[model samples]
Target chain A: MSEPDGGTVGKAMTVLDQVANFGRPVRFSELLKDSDFPKATLFRLVQTLTQQRLLTYDNQAQTYLPGLRLVQLAHAAWAQSSLATVAAPYLDELAHKFGEAVHLAQLENGQVLFIDKRQSVYRFDTLAQTGQVAPAYCTGVGKAILAFMAPMERDHALRQQAFVGYTPTTHGAPDSLLQELDAIRASGVAYDREEHERGIISIAAPIMSDDTNVLGAVSIATSTSRHTIESLDRFEAVLRSTAAQIGSAARVWRAPMPANPSYGNSGGENS
Target chain B: MSEPDGGTVGKAMTVLDQVANFGRPVRFSELLKDSDFPKATLFRLVQTLTQQRLLTYDNQAQTYLPGLRLVQLAHAAWAQSSLATVAAPYLDELAHKFGEAVHLAQLENGQVLFIDKRQSVYRFDTLAQTGQVAPAYCTGVGKAILAFMAPMERDHALRQQAFVGYTPTTHGAPDSLLQELDAIRASGVAYDREEHERGIISIAAPIMSDDTNVLGAVSIATSTSRHTIESLDRFEAVLRSTAAQIGSAARVWRAPMPANPSYGNSGGENS
Candidate 1:
């Protein structure tokens, strides 16, 4: 809550984030305890957000939760800005063909933000829900996207990584992770190897535009109980093809825009 | 373009809404054309929003679209505040059982806001996407929720209705809709009868808590080519039971809150 630099808008967004982070309908007092804003400022910010329908105040519960207006705005974001909508049919095809969960993700704020997922009907619980975030260093989709980024952009993103090891196989340092990225760049695929979670592993490929710009990544994820690391390699060819198809489709959809040298290829900055 | 009531936060939100309404990545010039703010004011606001990641500036396109942060916040809102997550399993069941699309919606600002939808594998094109808003006076889910609302609350919602006929079967006045609501109340369900969209009809039931609080509504929608108004009645019993099951499950999930008399039954105010 160090005052974000965008003035009143930033403060208001910070307040919105505070409420969302509570992850439940929360009391004003609870928000106050955690907020960096003064009591009066916090109150005014909350009131403004509620009035604008950015946060909904639950009367009976005497609590506030993220509002429906966010969902409305987010729908536009997902449909317009994200590759999720463009990749949906491909994800569905891959998921159905393999009968495993598939994830579509983009680098956001130097992290892996899962924008969409297709869970098979035979759903085994996997932690990757749409909109969930994970460390870029340890996840398959994240590494795949990172591996394909321009060197400068990749370096910037790597600088932001904490590289906390979540499992024995997790990357413990930027150097170690960079080595794997070099391999992924050569092979055109990345693997999770139960790095982010104990049992879950995935095979992932970076989706690249026809011009070789990194768009995002898609992954086919499963449990160690279901498949060994060697067995996961069986999906490599189909996964890469699906990624290519989505990338081609997305490029067509985005063809109207003039290309700027500064965007898309920069791993997560301004994403 | 009128300045909204909540000051800077309001103005900022208005800008955000403007971006979302564009429904595509749009240039600053395009946004300026539609904006009411002075050029300097608009520039500052846009810059602020972009910095906060409430809107993402597409450098390559030189345009802006709603941002990934909104998607993350929206995911929490959908999971925590919306009935979508609660009704998901039931929506899946109903959609599979009938091989028709099932919609979950809540009234927001006197309009029907679809929070979730389950489309059958045999997907026929329908206008109802998640986060899509429709008139409350005519749609099945809208009418069903209105039928169960407390009288004063229902009246408040009715006054907000424009009552423009979308089809020949659409309700044209409060009196006509009130008459239908009475029947729906008596019958414990509502039918669309191609009122909102020709050839598309639905059977809907209000999801109520054990205390009879209207949580929201669920509708199973289909085309006239698939089902007649009388034939739609075949789903009435199962639809009502599904709504009841969802209501029970949601109530349990929400049981931590103290009962407030003024909320949940108010149709759309503060929703």
Candidate 2:
């Protein structure tokens, strides 16, 4: 995940991410073992990052985790990002109405990053945790976003997918996934029928700006024991509407766009 | 706010923060006006930051904002910080029971940075937004944490306060605030009597680990129109218990230790 860009700043960030990727606080030696950077460089980077309060070091455990500074910055990011703050009330309403788990996800680094989640009142352990990442080839939210992308961007995003089969229903090749994407474009919906996980299923729709920009995706998830895939069909209209609401809201509430529009842009470039 | 430490890395972060402080997408010229760095230096910093994904540039608006990477890092921080994740269930219960806004906060750079918030069903525009920063001398969560800190640490923290009164009841000096802190330590809670905002009042309690370490604070905030200061007292027992539960949970699920403990150590150093 560490791409050597932006010189010293890039290196420092790589070290910072390594620690964060662990989720649990990590010791220096543990980081050293996993990092591609040399020991001296890694140590210096860690030291500087700690001094900057970008990485907090715990004395007792002798490990490092993300610092409070990151948390503070993230607050700003959430406000700017369309998926979390902009869609908060809508997600709340969706969860309240359906009485099932609801999730909002955005494409980050060509992978499906679950930005926010609302746990169902009747909880069963579902693998989709907030900030958890998954393959774009199998999951409902992932397919929803992939379906609406411009062909070139869609192909680029598709190439990045691992295409690992998680279950019998999972897409294992690019051609099969492309076929599904074509179908999703026509239907304006994507479904996961035990594709990502056994007994878990969800119906998803892509959130798009008025100009057809792929903002993100929203999904209503439940276990098969509680609800079948057909039962999830009842939520299609609601999911699409919720996604549209978020997309329009995102259009009004714009965030800073990237300098390189070819990679990730607000508007659908190919369209 | 920029101390100019860590050379290039520090300057880069300072530039990043100035953009974030705007709380909206900001142009390069606008950033230049507020930044301590020279124009060329500032430009370079922004470019490097954008490349690193620490800051995002909007090609359409030609502005900058916090990037998705920060959001990614923040997800890790939220889980690791313990205040938010460890206290999630408690916060949900508190908000559900009182049907009032619940805030969880931690001290950062002498300011109170809200880590998480549970909005009551009834929505009203109270000043506190999640991940928002507020003056430590005036807010309930701020004072609650301050009151429990060691005397020496308290004085250091107090020195950092601007003490600019936002309302008539806001603490104007260290002596008066110290008196309130003493009262809080004795009563096991702190109150904001429309101190930070004209109509906002909250009852808060410090979350502590063992006998001394002040982890953070939790508050039940409501508009004065909803309830009087005396009426807020009814929440004292519940707030204290909630704070205790979070503190205990935090102790069990600790994050990593710092390399240098003196600056921001875990222990209540004075004790």
Candidate 3:
């Protein structure tokens, strides 16, 4: 919270996330509104991050966003992170079995970075913007992974977090969220319960790493209008089984699937 | 080719490829053998890149590879490069229809970047290593795209190029490569013919931007033992139609897939 050295890199990272999280190139004013940073600080952060190739700018549009450098970096990290590949078959299977959208995302700085997504053939508004960020407390996949974090860390995250109530029921309290996470950890499943958006529910479970760190979470997102909670419970079983299978796969040969997971200080790979 | 500043970025990128292409972290000595640079200068470059987070260093192993920052960069690039997302449904349809590996790659700086890939349900070797680079003259997808390049640029890429003859059947002659491109252009399809590998055969078509610039190429790779040219042709109609579908998507979207169609690219999202 204190900065005089400019925290050049951290500031740049902040600007990058704002854009990366925006799901599209963001205008400078949009940056200020989203990050709640001072206008001048946001400007310098954008400019420097752009100069570093950590962020790229489209001059004509006067917008800022993550640059090619991040793609290059993500590719390299993916080789080390095996979640992307490990979850592919499972996500594919989930998509096929459920005829709905399946996705894998990691909690980064308290938001979801969708690493990979599979669309349903059924054609629904379930289309997710891969690499887009959403509040960690509202989505099943995010809560599933967050449930595994240390109690202290989870509390800290909840305290400092700014959550948007996409619907009327987005989770907000540390105590209540703790209960949800405990349920996920105990039963090996997490549910959206129409919290993230109206008329949508997702069932999710965490995929672990070799050391049993929650590396990321996988989920099936569908419409609440289409699938009732009882049917969703059945699909939750499927989602949990799929996540477990991916965990075993990740530990076996460590193929490059690259889903960002909450590793419980296992390199802090998660939030 | 020369000293420090001349090929600074190239050598650094080569080290990146060595790690990325192999799907594992590479040792310093192994990297030394893979590149032709003085040890001292290589050390500096690696350190600088690591410092910049363009690359990473594993302290325990003393090996250098791409860092999470690079993955972030790649992800950021994909965030902006909408080509992959736009083309994904088409790749999905192609994979579902053909039940083979589908890859979308772009030529970048005389190499290829495998921006996006989807595999069949059955087992197969991986076709994409997201950021790795390889030769352009000998790959089906490579030639298919190169065939669309401006003549002068294409000729320039071929100059002083050693075709390496991945197989004896590889077209090493500049004349033959030019000839093949012509046929591909005429026929609207390009063939690999076991040029890149003995057991693999592929056919590719280009996805062009609204400006008619070749944004990237897509290919279907299958085993020579199981898939004959005729069999591949059986799927050709769908493949070409799928490619055109992706092309149209790219044009309508104006934003290229969330990936740069880099040169001689290999592997997908496998940092």
Candidate 4:
């Protein structure tokens, strides 16, 4: 029910999304290219957002990044979110167990927002910091959660925008993308298969509440050379059990926020 | 030159500050009680911040907390800041070496904004999560940085507010605080002897670049019962060496933005 069109809040979100995509404090000129946002509008939006502390304007770099206020907001959201905190110890254990990087991410606006992660002491990591966002159609955590969304909801989410191919192995075009999501649903697990970044592979499973509401997804990420299909199958069982431990523990902290007309996740206006 | 007086941005920032003071989100009535601001002001401010994605509104909890955008922003800042990346691995090593909590913090609004942390693998931990802010007057990392700030910058910063004491050990008067900072500058390290919290103790070393500009601070935090004065002396040498390694490594990635008149640290106006 929320308008996704360009407005102050929407444009501010777009600028932030650009920063997230690049994982850099993008210069204003660079943001203009992919965004196609008007120059003046972008400036005003960025300025206001910076002033409000929603964005950080680096005087030394002349670039835009999300501000401390933004981090605080994400902390607030995740604080209410059970999966991030409850799974912290589990993530560490899983990473230690597999000697790989394990991540827990939940889907928001059709993308995977990495809430927590633990990397093995000797793993090669591409530096995906916590709170980083990645596309849902390609990554294991993304695909794991995508498999569970109601068909219509999933369709609506995918239809919300175009998918950019991150690597040659990325699945694009709606028809093919939908087929892959369906495959994940059938299997109860998802594989990255180097679709996000070359040489990286991951195996993942979703966690659900006692009521069967999908909570989030967890993954064991590693270089493809280290994990074969058979090896991943063995890891998946551990992943699933680990996710269950997380979900059950999350129950104590992941309480539902009271419904208020003015606040909450961007859903249930219809409800 | 900028007014610190209350306005929309001020209301919004204060709202965030209040939310951070809480362990979790609180109801609007609770926010009113927690803050000196009026009810209507708090409500309107919460809605604006929620809409702008600076704060999250939990209809279920009927309370507001920091939002996802803030987490994204902090992560973004963490990603872009060379200090964070260079020190991350070493921070881990130091934490493992010391078998206690280690933290990296930068000065923001004369307070220590936690940039990163590694908790000791123990059953109990004292300090809060990643985005938690601690007073500069009491904490080791905060004192390390503040004690080194260019004099005028330091004075102007202290002029902006009152010192609300958090603990009996917290320094309440600005003059005593400045004197302590001066003594810390004469020495090379800063120590927090249960000044922030009653049972916690920490030793911090300032991270300085080749040109000796203060980059940030790294500290080893532990329970006083776990460490004695002799142990801290030995630990301080490790902290200083680790900070040097981090400072030097960060130099290779020093793509600092030009100092813009419009952009400034909370302590001083941009040059």
Cα-based RMSD of the predictions, in order? 3.3, 4.4, 7.8, 4.7
Q: Please, what are the lDDT tens digits per residue for candidate 1 over residues A163-236?
A: 88789999899888889999999999999999999999999999998555797999999999889989999999
Better of 1 and 4 by TM-score: 1
Ranking by lDDT: 1, 2, 4, 3
Question: What's the lDDT of the predicted structure labeled candidate 2?
Answer: 0.84
- TM-score for chain B of each model, two decimals: 0.90, 0.91, 0.79, 0.80
- DockQ for candidate 3: 0.23
Per-residue lDDT of B83 in model 1: 78
Predicted structure 4: lDDT = 0.74
Chain A TM-scores, per candidate, are: 0.91, 0.88, 0.76, 0.79
lDDT by residue for model 2 over A1-271, one digit each (tens)? 3455647888888888888889887889999999887999888888888878898876656668789888788777767775688898999999999989999998876888888899888888688766677888899999999999877888889989888888999888999889998999999999998888999999999999755569789999999999999999999898889889998888767633444354444653210
Off by over 4 Å in 1: A1-3, A210-212, A257-271, B1-3, B210-212, B257-271
List runs of model 2 lying over 4 Å from the truth. A1-3, A254-271, B255-271
Please provide, for model 1 over B1-271, each residue's C-alpha lDDT reduced to its tens digit, 9 standing for 90 to 100: 2445549888888899899998888899888999888999999889888888889987767789999988888888888864787789999899889889899999887899889998956688678888778898989999999999878888888998999989999888999899999999999999999999999999999999855578799999999998999999999999999999999999888886665544554435442
> What is the full ranking by TM-score, best candidate first?
1, 2, 4, 3
Query: How far does residue B179 in candidate 1 sit from its true spot (Å)?
Result: 1.8
Expressed as tens digits, the lDDT of each residue in B83-143 for candidate 2 is 7888989999999999999999999878998988888677876777666788899999999
lDDT of 3 by residue, B1-271 (tens): 3342233344555555556655566676776776676888666656655655555564434456565445544565774665777887788788887788888887755666677777766667755555545567877778878888777777776773577888988987788888888988888778888887788888888776644467778998888878887778887788777777877776667544334344454323210
Q: Candidate 2, what DockQ?
A: 0.47
**What shift in Å separates residue A252 of candidate 2 from its native position after superposition?**
3.6
- Which residue pairs in model 1 clash with each other? none
Highest-scoring model, DockQ: 1
Q: Say which docking band candidate 3 falls in.
A: acceptable
